[model samples]
Target: MYTVNQLGKMYNLSRSTLLYYDKIGLLKPSARSEANYRLYSKNDLKRMEKIATYREAGLSLESIADILNSDDTNSTTILEQRLHSLNSEISELRKQQQLVVELLGKDSLVRTAKIMNKEQWVNILRSSGMDEDDMHRWHREFERDLPEVHQDFLESLGCSPEEVSSIRKWSQ
Candidate 1:
């Protein structure tokens, strides 16, 4: 049997986190000492390891508890559902990554256009019918407010606000 501290060190988890797991009845130790210290066996360690694995795979504690406690639920069905969810998440992230790559390419084009002579720039803008004053106003407004607006846009896109804002500014 291992003490709580020993178990925590072995698993690289904090004592409080283990205690919280115990309090929630997620992984109750198999035994206790006369001095009231928690004692865990090999079986307990195996259970904790399984819990950690499920958590890393994005299963919530509540869901994990249900899976562990449910007698009628088939483990194979639960695993298949989790696999489907992970695959869907991966697909969505790949789509977002493709959008980022396209945006970066557009930013490169914009930068190349900016480096052109004034007349060339003006002609390009004229061909596009993009007004100079409007462009300037837009640039200034984006400079001042884009961090927040981009944050909102990214949140809508299911990306981290900070990460999306950084990517948006990277194009500028």
Candidate 2:
């Protein structure tokens, strides 16, 4: 048996997180010491490992709970959904990587990635057949992924406050 702190350390989780899991009925200690400290058994550790795996796969707490509660958990559908989501994300990242590579090839060793100003980025998007909606999605993804960098990039483009506000609002 292990204390709650020791169990959390084994899983690289915080004490409060374990307490929250216990409170939510997602995980419970095998026993308690005379002082009322939580004690985890090997079975609890195995369950915690499964919980961590599901969480890392992006399953919601409620979904994880349902799966744990169900005797015949139909996980194939959920796994397929997650796989599809991951594939789409991979495809998007690949497109971004290709765009970066193409941009880099536009100049010699002296010019850096910073040279692609706002107008150039917009032009590139347009030339790549990115319509208004596609451009908006791209900007929204950019802002969502890196808000500070997006702001700095817009500023580097020398866009006015009104322009920046308009662009951000439209992209959103």
The best candidate in terms of lDDT: 2
Model 1, span 28-139: residue lDDT tens:
9899999988999999999888888888888878877877777545655677788888766865765575465456775454443312323454477678877877655554
Q: Which lDDT values do the candidates have, in the order given?
A: 0.71, 0.78
lDDT (Cα, 0-100) at 110 in candidate 1: 46
Model 2: per-residue lDDT, tens digit, 30-99?
Answer: 9999999999999999999989999998888887887777755456666677777876675465446546
Report the Cα RMSD per candidate.
Answer: 14.7, 11.8
Ten residues in sequence with the least summed lDDT for candidate 2? 108-117
